[model samples]
Target: MTAARLISVNVGQPRDVELNGEIKQTAIFKDPVPGRVKVVDHHVDGDRQADQVNHAGVHKAVYAYAREDLDFWAAELGREIEDGFVGENLTITGYDVSHAVVGERWRVGGVEFEVAQPRIPCWKLGVRAGDKSMTRRFELALRPGAYLRVVAEGEVGAGDTVEVLSRPEHGFTVADASRIFHRDRAEAARLLAVDELAPPLKQWARKRLGLELEEEGG
Candidate 1:
């Protein structure tokens, strides 16, 4: 298969916006950067997450969404969607982000990244789309994109070739993660097999398997 390519590098800062008649601060409004940008351990150099408590972390330092998915949405919504419209840090082409497996390592430009988990839609996404049901729709569509952890800090820019260096044997993919998060709560073993998954996802799996209370008590 041909190498996947980074279509755009996007960055944004937190800003206040009115959503559902309430003032809210969000960093979902991103614009493509013109040149190479630094990829750090915690986040991209020019990007910031408004909700540090839930959004920004080592496990979710960067978000990648497929350009094809954006095109799909554009057709579905009957409107043009730009590269960073979905709040992705990296807009990628030639690969299915939803099929990315946890622990899969990708080398892009000079940086290396690991697939950490699938994104879980929040109210902010719905607000950004100007529809309260957008979150539910995103969850149901099961194409919520993938979050990545920076394994090696380096500079990256648009048109960088993405090389897959490794993939885990567990076979747990981002689509499977989304299924476990949304519909299939019985796949605890599959969820646990992805050892590199974020702690929150692991906890969700434990809860689905009725092990959270037991583990907590012990």
Candidate 2:
């Protein structure tokens, strides 16, 4: 396999954006930052999540998107896709973020991270894209990037190599998790057995399997 490397490291501060008729706080407009940046408790030193309810937490800490995926979208959108265009903290290349195993561990520079889950586009994504239909477009794109949890906080920067430390024996990937959450009960049943699956996704799978209610879901 070709080595994977960090293309860019990005972060953003919350900004007021006009959505529909009201102003809303969003941090989806991330820009690449030069030099090394520390990975703190749950995010990069200069990054902050605007909405905590659905974004930014231990399990959804560092978002990573593949540069190849961005290239695909750029061609589709008839424009150049910038690094961190979709709010990802790390823009990577060579490794497929969407296919990353859910429990896989990787090290970039001095930081260690675990694959946590796949991104689920929201209205904030549309706001960032400047298109009301972007959320739906992204969902259909099937290139949903992966979110990672920090295992060992340290610093990272552009050109840093992404090194895989270990991986679960099971083949449960971010794409499978995304599919289960979106619409596949059978797949959910199979993947729920993977002990290393992210807890939030496990809860969601249980709810999908009728073992819990939506209110009890993650």
Candidate 3:
């Protein structure tokens, strides 16, 4: 596969927002930052997640979005959606990491990351898009961006080459996970065997397949 390049490094902090007459904190608003930036096990140096329980963790450390996907949404939405506008910490060009195999390993500058899962859309996503239906539309679009776990903490910058260091043999892609979750419910079983599949997905699969109790019994 052709190499992909990092288009931008974005960061934002959680802030209070009024949505539906209720005050909520969201870190979904991100903007591109120039030059190199530090990356850690939990997040990019200055980035944060509003929901610590679900959105914050080593498994969901860095969120990545494809510039191609961004353009697609821009054309579909009939508006210019800039890089990092979708709350992705890394905006990439060329290869859309959306197609990356589950547990695939990639290197950006000195940072190492493992493709852990897709960025499952939520209410914050809709808020970021300024459209209440964006969360659902994003699911149906099947362009779910990638969430990467930090394997080796370091620094990354715009224009860095994204090197595919290794790929998990399981063959499940980030987009595949999104599709299975939203449209192909039956494929949940296939994900159960993938050790690198996201934890929430694994749990959902076990429950859907009625194997949760069986696994617990083992």
Colliding pairs, model 3 = none
TM-score of 3: 0.94
Q: Compare candidates 1 and 3 on lDDT and give the better one.
A: 3
Q: lDDT by residue for model 1 over 1-218, one digit each (tens)? A: 66789989999999999876889999999999988999986798899999997898999999999999999888877899999987999999999988998889999999999999999998888777887888898889989789999999999999999888999888788888898889987776677777898888888778778776755654
Question: lDDT for each of the candidates?
Answer: 0.89, 0.89, 0.90
Q: 1-218 in candidate 2: lDDT tens per residue? A: 77999989999999999998999999999999999999999999999999986898998999999999999988978898899999999999999999999889999999999998899889998898788888888877778899999999999999999999999888788888777666665777766787766677788778778998788333
Candidate 2 deviant stretches above 4 angstroms: 216-218
Candidate 1 total steric clashes? 0
Could you tell me the C-alpha RMSD of candidate 2 in Å? 1.8
Q: Estimate each model's TM-score.
A: 0.94, 0.94, 0.94
Question: How large an RMSD does model 3 have?
Answer: 3.1
Q: Write the residue-wise lDDT of candidate 3 on 25-107 in tens digits.
A: 99999999988999975799988888988887988899999999999999989999999988999999988678989999999
